[model samples]
Target: MESSLPSTQILDSGESAEGKNEAKNYNEVMSTLPKVKSLNGYDYYLYQGFWYAPFFLEGLMSVQEHFNPQSTDIFVASFPKTGTTWLKALTFAILTRSRLSGSTTSALLSKLPHDCVPFLEYDLAQNPSNRDLAIPLVSTHVPYSCLPKSIISASCKIIYICRDAKDAFVSLWYFLAKQRRSENVEPLPLEKSFELFCNGIANYGPYWDHLLGYWRASLEFPEKILFLTYEEMKKDTAAHVKKLAEFMGCSFTLEEEEGGEVQMIISLCSFEKLSNLEVNKNGKHRPDTSIAIQNSIYFRKGEIGDWANHLTPEMGARLDDIMDQKLKGSGLKLPR
Candidate 1:
């Protein structure tokens, strides 16, 4: 548990020399990385051909330099807005079901899934006090190529979840709008957001490239990478939850399986059940930073193909065409 990064805020930022040095390094990366306009007003830096928010870039750099992964560690990896919250909830439940005993509910009832499984880069690496967390379970939005080398070299398992490109974009627009609204800043227009998104200029984006990075890696290292798509999970959640449990090295026992634990976990983490919880509806994930986002933004209509409601036919087909071209001959076909 040497790398267990605690969730509770610890005000040790100015006290530790390592924290200062990490902050200095983060600043250096922030200042030197090539910068571009983000979908919103904040600047995103083009690093390794994809765009990343400045804070997350700092986190990527910090996690790379310091996060030490153990073989037991399980990383839930994905691009933003790709059912990350859902995956985090399911993964946490599967891994910690032993502690749940006979109850259908778990900590998820009280904490946001993001709170239960903190982001390796954005949540932990961005917060200096959380630099060396001892926890084994972590999630990340960092692309596969940019992930901490320790995660790869240490031979840990990664559970990745993806969604249809169109749906992912739709979810992202709503999430961003909610964030900006919370801060009283004007959100980007949907058309403008779509334009930047197609160009691969959004946060942790160039969507096709981000998806392709892990898609290809999962192909090359099937044992180490359990790639999942949101559509597939929504189609049959129980089966996928079982797959996740197995991949995470905690497959349900015959008794547990027969006892309806799988279904219990699914229901416990379902969007409907979670969205109504007072904690999720009213709470805010206040990291040590000044920015505190409403937990409610994380819970929208977790419907597949909600893009139809948001994007026109032309916009949908255009993104699909782009993804098809980008993934052509790569043996990856995104759900249309």
Candidate 2:
């Protein structure tokens, strides 16, 4: 058998460049990787058996090289459009509520979740000397397999969120469509994107495989990883918030709950409140990057079964079959 893998590029400190042109260096490295076409009509590179969008590769390299995870650090991990924005908001609000309570201002009052709790990969890319790494509240869309070894070695706690395949697919499609429109590129057709999704070629997809990586990890190390579902969180926001608070080791005291702190957090992090906030509605996450996405782009309907408006019954059934087949015997159940 012949190996067709690209030349190996290990994570390096890049001290020689003094952190200059890191993105260019990463792009040069990416040019050498095995490449494939994605359903979204972009080039994805094959790295360690998983495909990744070229835009994220640079930041991922930064994460691999520089992220020195600590046990006290908390991570919010998820596949794209799986309520990641919402989770970040909730977690940040939960953990920082006490510290920020006395201030006249709130984090969410000015910063979006992506701003308050930055993505590990992209955030590190922008600010290589990130001061917050000591006890960071980081988020990432990277698959579990590709996460920096430091994250696992340091035993950092991770909160992983999963969504039903149908809804996730719908949300991902719209998200990508908006992105393409922002860049003045014609959006990938929905039917074509759906086919690619089923074939396991969408961004960070095979969704089931990505879900299983964390699902199995949570099963193996329940203490290190808390598995969550967007549907479940939406169904009982208060209960899930309590659970998240407990897992983060900052459970609300009875006195606080009695004072309605839980409800306060929920209201502050609510989809309606966050989405409509002037900052989130008009701000840009990273305006200078290749993927200069608006904060408002992350706010869609944020509901269940929006797929019904997009996917036909036959299409839904086909995805269901694929999910059933791929997740067979995995002991993982995504909300329907």
Candidate 3:
């Protein structure tokens, strides 16, 4: 394949420019990858058999080269728009509650969930030392197949979240609409995007491949990977939080529960509470694309079965049938 990279990259930043290991050849490497049009008008690359947005590729490359995992590290993994923000907020609150001063809810005050639980393939590579490494908890949208071998071999625990295909499709379309507006490009129409989604052409997709990679992993390593669905968590968040806490080895005590700690955490991380926070409402997050997005962009209705409002019944059935085919005999079910 023809490379756009300088024939040589200082693959190791510490190495001399005159020597080998140059990784600065990102553009070169990126140009050679298999590319496809996305809902937002930019090209998505086929990386390891799945598609990913171009913006995340650079950071992900650095991550692959530099990330060193520890047994104590915890990860929250999910495909886009599958309650990732909420899961991040909940995990941040659950794990940090015992360490904060004053009220337990203080940990989440004025924070975006994305800020609290940084992305492994982006934020961590940007600042590995930002948060004190005390039981480092991070998140990733990277498919399990593409994750750094270090992470796969490490004893770290991973929690994977996914949602119903129809809802996930609707959510991603709306999300990409924001990115399209940011880029000053015409938004990919819903019908067009939905078709692409069904074909597994969105960012971080081959959606079935992304889901099954982790699903199969969670089954093989039950203790290391906890798989949860968005609908289940929403049906009973409190119970889910407890389960999350226990899985992370931080179960709330009887005294803490009696004192209303669990409920307090739930209220503080609730979508209503989070969406209204001044920080989330007005804050800006800069992605590798250098686009400053209003943190509020991440705050959507978050309602389950919302696909009905946006998609035709036939559209839903098409996706449901596709998922059924993909999930058949896998022993995993996604809400229809």
- For model 2, the stretches where C-alpha displacement exceeds 4 angstroms are 1-32, 102-104, 126-128, 131-135, 288-290
The lDDT values for all models are 0.80, 0.80, 0.80
Which pairs clash (backbone N, Cα, C closer than 3 Å) in model 3?
4-28, 5-28, 9-22, 10-21, 10-22, 10-23, 11-21, 11-22, 11-23, 12-21
lDDT of 2 by residue, 161-267 (tens): 98999999999989888877776778788999899889887666678889999999999999989999999999999999999999999999999999988898898
How does residue 81 of candidate 2 score in lDDT? 88
lDDT of 2 at 232: 92
- Residue 27 error, candidate 2, Å: 4.9
Task: Please provide, for model 1 over 1-336, each residue's C-alpha lDDT reduced to its tens digit, 9 standing for 90 to 100.
Answer: 001122222213545776666666666666777887777767788887778776667667767877776688888988889999999888888877887665445888888988888778665665534422444688888788888898899998888889899999889988988888777889889999999999888888888888889989999999999989999898999999988888877888999989889988888889999999999999988644565778899989999888999999999999999888999999988665
Model 3 error, position 79 (Å)? 0.4
Q: How accurate is candidate 2 locally (lDDT)?
A: 0.80
Summed over model 1, clashes come to: 8
Estimate the overall C-alpha local distance difference test score of candidate 1: 0.80
Residue-wise C-alpha lDDT for candidate 3, range 103-218, written one tens digit per residue? 43464666677877767766576556645577478899989988888898887899999999999989988887876676676788999999999999988897888899999999
Q: What would the TM-score be for candidate 2 when compared with the true structure?
A: 0.90
Instruction: List candidate 3 stretches off by more than 4 Å.
Output: 1-24, 101-105, 287-289
On TM-score, who's better, 2 or 3? 3
| Rank order (by TM-score, best first) | 1, 3, 2
Select the stronger candidate by TM-score from 1 and 2: 1
Off by over 4 Å in 1: 1-22, 126-135
